[model samples]
Target: MNKNLRVPVGIFGIFLIIAITLTYTLNNLFYLVNFLYIGSILSIGIYLFVINNKYGRHLVQFTIGLYMVIFLGIILQENMQLSGFFYYLFLGVFQAAVIHYAIAKIFGPVLFGRGWCGYACWTGMVLDILPFKTPKNHERVKNLGLLRYMIFILIFIGVLILFYLNVPNLDYLMFIIFILGNLIYYAVGIVSAYILKDNRAFCKYFCPITTFLKPASYFSLLRVKNTSEKCIKCNKCINNCPMDVDMLDNRRKRKNGTECILCLECISNCPTKSLKI
Candidate 1:
């Protein structure tokens, strides 16, 4: 078997394990189908990426993003947003948004890093199509990253307030908030992209989910590695990174190491093919 093919196969096996485990533990067949679908699409996308298909990553983004936003969020009213996670959590419900957050935004990052941001995020799926695939200024805005934590705290407080007040029709209200939250995310993401000339401005500066993703992702099992022998110091990889990760340095404590989303833009642009995952 080709070495590159191992990545997708390994990823598929991991998802299969999760699917089976969740199905058995929860006694719900929905988890089997849900995780199987996600795994299949992700495996296929990774396979395409290995074959050097330019549209491979986009394929995963669109299929998974649309399914989450349209089918889960809108049609099924699952409210898979950050607020929805808190809502389900506060109600002591282990299903729906809580499960989604656990597997995707929380513990899962320890295994796959922020692959969700790269290939499965509904918000990122939209922002990626903007004109700035790479930022005009490679330097990140000073202290702007602090906004994500503030937003995280505010959302936590907002949910606590709702639960404290015993808000009526809470389920329906969560659905409404989910829709409005996505709209606000899209608006802020797009506006920030144009203003910052970086397609990932919202992710870098304002996404509350990063508060969960970043901490665990510091120990991600999967990450890009750089070969010093092949590196000619052309700086193309750093120049192309959307997340400003210093992937050239293989150390775990490298600058912005936790910010890596596994987008592979750095690898793809590496002049000497020095970067790999």
Candidate 2:
């Protein structure tokens, strides 16, 4: 029962106010330069900047703020389709060959410590909107953390099989699956955060992107680690960590956990300020 959530309720309230206001204002003016879309971006940007006041230093907030900036950029650009950006490059049917070649055949991690989760994941943004306090029962499901790799392989294989067969409606199928998957994921995330008191079980036990990022993130420069002899085992670091990593445990083992997202929440919220880069 951690019972301490850094994210405040007023944050969501602000988002709602802005969203509703923009919806009515921009939707009504939809004919005027497509202000609806632009207004939505502005509304979200204002909300994030305003909400940052509550959890300005938290890692989750930092990650979310970074993503909002990128998303706003894309929405404003008008040439870049957000769905295409995600599907074509990062997590679409076409990406299988690139992922397999880089991660499997070449035997290299994809990035470094799943930094993508912190930066580009739209699903993570959805969860970041919810306010929940306390860590959940992430004790240990199994030692074969490699299960996620197996899942990725299977998904890649399915994509390849369908590709070689020249299956009709493939793009449409992928689009449908993508939309449904996101809906289910965010639905689950919101429900879990509300009822189960944990915001990140989706990241822990389920996210396919997390699996992709795992191999890539080992080589990333942006990562999380405890400083030299600074932590006092106050558990603030662990408590504040959205990813449920036992920072104290990492300190004891002289390693950063594989799931670390480098969001600065732990460091900022630590009472002794022992949590650091």
Candidate 3:
């Protein structure tokens, strides 16, 4: 294979494996179709990025984002939210929203880091369109990251209570909660973006899903690395990083290292291309 084709080909092959394996195991043709579509979209996005299209990342985000949000969440009523995860988990069912959480936000982080946030997150698609793509120091207030834990605990507790109460029409309730949850997420995301002057304020400060993503991503096979030789210490990478990741620090345990969304903004901003993802 041509070197330029390596990334896309690898991604396509991986998704093919996933598609085949899941379809065979689950005896569901939908798995094959679903994975094929997502794979193709991601492969195209990767190719565009290799060719240096300015909107390559955005293309993937919007394509996968809108499909997951509208088709799965709204039309199919799949409930692809944190609450949905808890709801499904409590039911001991491995299908639907639980599978999505396992593959995208949980174990998937170990392989691709927070690539979902950059490429396919419906919430991020909306948040990234805000004015503040790059966050300033003042916008990142201290201790705000702790809020995600609070949100996580609250979601878990809320779901547990509902289950304990033997709530009827639980599927209907989940569908409603999914809609309401997304609305609250968007409202909070937009408000936080404006107030913090950072487009990713909601992601950095209060996304409950991060509780799963961060720890796994710490051991991720793919992550941005910084080399100081050609860096010039210009601070361009830090300035443009939406996640406030210290790309200048090469260690995997660097401050906010687990927060990297693999958005490549820092790499794009580097004068000497010292940053590699």
RMSD of each: 1.0, 11.3, 1.3
> Candidate 1, residues 1-277: lDDT per residue as tens digits?
8887897898889899999999999999999999999999999999998888988899999999999999999999998999989988888999978988998889989988999999999999999999999887778899999999999999999988998899999889989999999999999999999999999999999999999999999999989999659699888998899888888789999988999989898988898988977
- How accurate locally, in lDDT, is each candidate? 0.92, 0.50, 0.89
Question: Per-residue lDDT tens digits of candidate 3, residues 198-258?
Answer: 8999999989999999999999999998865877999888888888888888899987899
Q: Is candidate 1 or candidate 3 better by TM-score?
A: 1
Best TM-score goes to which candidate? 1
lDDT of 2 at 222: 45
Q: What's the CA error at residue 131 for candidate 2, in Å? A: 4.0
Using all chains and alpha carbons, the TM-scores for the candidates as numbered come to 0.97, 0.57, 0.97
Model 2 lDDT per residue over 1-277, tens place = 2212222333334335544654465464322322233334433433443354444324444444343334432333211222323334433433322332333212322333453455335566567666664465545456444554665566556656666687797656655544565576678777866765666656666555555455455554445566658667777777677777776653423333667765557766777756545
- The predicted structure with the larger TM-score, 1 or 2, is 1
Model 3 residue-pair collision total? 0
